[model samples]
Target: MSTNRRTFLTGLAAAGGFAIASPAVLGQAKPRVVVIGGGAGGATAARYIAKDSAGAISVALIEENEVYQTCFHSNLFIGGFKSYEEISHRYDALAKNHGITLARARATQIDRDKKEVVLSTGARLPYDRLVVSPGIDLKYDSVPGWSKDVEEAMPHGWKPGRQTQLIKQKLDAVPNGGTILMIAPPNPYRCPPGPYERASMFAHVLKASGKRDCKIFILDPKDSFSKQGVFQEGWEKHYGAMIEWLGPKVHDGIKSVDPKTNTVVTGFETYKDCAFVNVIPAQMAGEIARSAGLAPAGGYCTIDPASMKSVVDPNIFVLGDACIGGDMPKSAFSANSQAKVAAMVIRGELAGARTFPARYINTCWSLIETDDTVKVGGRYEAKDGKIAAAETFVSQPRESAELRKENQAENVGWYAAITADMFS
Candidate 1:
């Protein structure tokens, strides 16, 4: 370790459990970084900044949850291909190994002018830089007659955690020959291919459970979806006639939902007697971001494509599903990529580290069946004041079986690597 790192470690050891020490007490200024949220983007950002800075910067991570269950690969858990425990990750390593102060409290407000974060416990944390990556919040009312109270009957399962378990329970309890109704969200939502991947998972569980007569209906607001050809081909090959996708032209629009009777009233027709329902409503940046006035008309935080700094507040950096990443779809991988760019910029500004041009990459992998996977991704860079796609690829229909298996294996490997990068 360098002399600067040794001095940093000594300061941390002297400060005890306190991640940030007063300038008067330390006899020098210690730049502090406060990060909110512990998901893909937030966790990765916190770890990289704290680790690469080598304790030169005081880092505090605020997250309400002790253990985080990833929204990524959650469909595999629901499909019985992976266990819930396998997808769940603990944050102890981040604190113990990376020297991040774990503030197990919700951040109630962001005082951007003051450069401080107010916690639910009424404590205030002052920071030189703040990273806000609280992810997406579902707009329950976006779909008429739907809210949190009625979510039990028609769980979105979009946020992971309890909703994920509930959806799996509902899926297992679904009777043979039952029909499942899924209302897919519009464009610019987290994980563009998530709902369709979930549909495939539901089909897998039903088929594996010998409920061959069970069927699913996907009502999408958009005319087309991510990897439409690949997903359609995979569904036809594996699910046969089990799944049906209806676009806006067919469903007209979702008028209302009666969760009590498991009914969905669309502009075209009324769907009643649905055995299970998953309604992924429109989304916005999390409450903290909205309350801070960081988001604009699009309901997402807009940032400088080169640095990931919020347009509204230079001291605040936004990441993941909450930020409007130009050509990059809102996915965990995209968020992780953005986090690194933001971290590099912050370090360059605060720690005098060398800065480089921002380059980003993202790949979204969706499993359609056992050993059948499809993907869409691209390389991105800061160009013309926006994150522009440089190169892109997508899985095509009628690929070789070996190639499909390889894609599935690659997905599994990525999950392992990314979770380690975030929490371990």
Candidate 2:
């Protein structure tokens, strides 16, 4: 290893974030860890803790759903690149291979004072340490005239699963020369690049079906979005005049929506009888996380960058979209990377295992068109009590076809690798 790597390892060895809880030394039973919301972060943390501890720690993964549907690649499914089953994963591998106990029940409450998790079934689970990775939840009133009840008519496929399927069906039902509208979410939401990719998917499907006349309009609330240069360039090159993006400055923000008539009233223009509409409203941390007192008024938990432990309660770790990950965007790759650091720290403390310094990395890949993909990524480390970017890179505009194709292949491979890291 290099000198800097050695220094990091030395620091990890010298640090005692949590007291060693070795059962032999303390004359106690194996330490039990409970993880909530088994998606990207929770699943990986539970599996790593169980596998690394080698029965020194008992792990329970409490998730309401037996199968996890990923929000990351649901856009590809909409574009007909993947199927619903392809993006779905099960917890069978974590249980059979890593000895993780899977509980298919929702966690209703987090009793931090008692160090217990109350489940929806009225059972309480005790944890020596708790890991929570509940993902984003929609703020229905964030959009004018939009609420949870009208989601079936105007679907926001942000959470994945049935909503994702609903959006795909709406896209498929649009006729040639039909109008499709998407109200993109505001800042600091889950997946900075997701809304743009979904728009690309919409154009891709319509263009493929020779529905080039079908109009796709994006009413964006933000001034600029992730990878705006490349995404806009790709849209002009592949699906010219088929997609139109109007920022807040141009549209003067959304005035109201008539869900019954599939209409949107904007300051500049009123779009009526839109064949398809996707209204992704503002979002916050999931309800369970807020209820646990892990979040403040910001609706996200501040975590210690070195350990992914919640700043509010040292005994609890918050991961994924629920935590305020300074530089790391809310993505599966970021969550999975953070989980490794958390698992190592938990193992080092409770099982007396070796520890390593935390290094977080993330790359968000967006597929623009056939064999055309772009990505933005960075390496982050804890510095001055917060995560900061050490190195970063993004794909430039008008790249070579061969290089873009390679990037697309990389995106596909990463999806496979990350899902395996989380579930298997």
Candidate 3:
């Protein structure tokens, strides 16, 4: 094996040894693994552990909602490429097919010392191992002049479900020649490509709705964004003069927002009387993780890149957007990939299953316009104690129509496969 690969495997073996040596409670009939959150990370981890264990371990999945509408494809729903039902998933199959227990309650707290999850329904669910995949919680007050009370007027739509539909409704209500201003979040946010995709989707809706005069403005705090070239090309070709992106250099910085007046003041200029505003503020790990003292400094849990086990507590694993994933972008595919690693390590530690070296894969696809999509992804390995990128690929700008269409197909196929992986 290569030097990096050898080092990576050695780290995995050492982490596995540490997990195996973790103190276990006595007098248990079956080792119980409790997973928090039912999104891509927690759902995939729960399914894998339950299925691969083959009745050797019990898996309990704790989630607030029974039906999950994926944030990954919700942009397509906003663009009218997919329906709400297409992005929605239920956990019934996970219970029936995989023999996993679905606990339909919000996780209020994580008792690290007691090894239990406190639910909103005043129940304590004990576990030998805890998998926390509660995705990001929006910092509503992070953006100036924005807060939870004004969210209805200026929707974030970062979390899937009601916000997604609300944003779609707000977009539909925009009059012809109206303006929509979207405040993109800063760095280290979930789905690095998301804000740009949402802008594309918004443009798609306005263009297809015969509102050619409608304009969408993305005020980004970052200098550049994911698939910038491909998205720019597609926007220019399809929505010509309909979209604008103001980087920090151009916008200076967001000064303030007035929800009642539908106005936003930036350091350089002020946008007045906007028809709609998407204020996606800064984000951090879900509230449960923060409340549990799992997130120390970065507002995210630090985990061993080799095993996805928390550096704070070896028995608790963090997945998805809640953990620092080294080089991995906080996307559903990355979460699902990390979930498998956590499941493998958990099985190895608790069920005496053989373990292998950790290898992670992620592909993020963004639909630029109808039948036009771009992708970026890579294979990753634990190197130098971080999940470092090994091999990477991305769609190029000015690709042929056929190639873009094929990429779009791949995007659709991946959504189906991943949602099935998580919920089915």
Query: In model 3, how large is the Cα lDDT of residue 203?
Result: 92
C-alpha TM-score for every candidate: 0.93, 0.96, 0.96
Which candidate should be chosen as best, given lDDT against the real structure? 3
Model 2: lDDT to the true structure:
0.90
Mind giving the per-residue lDDT tens digits that candidate 3 earns over 132-152? 999999988788899999999
In order, what is each prediction's RMSD in angstroms?
Answer: 6.7, 1.9, 1.7
Task: Give the least accurate 10-residue stretch of model 1, judged by summed lDDT.
Answer: 17-26
Q: Which portions of model 1 miss their true places by more than 4 Å?
A: 1-28
Kindly report which residue stretches of model 3 are placed more than 4 angstroms away from their true locations once superposed.
1-28
Ranking by lDDT: 3, 1, 2
Better candidate number, 1 or 2, judged by lDDT: 1
Spell out the clash pairs found in candidate 3.
none
Checking candidate 2 for backbone clashes, the offending pairs are none
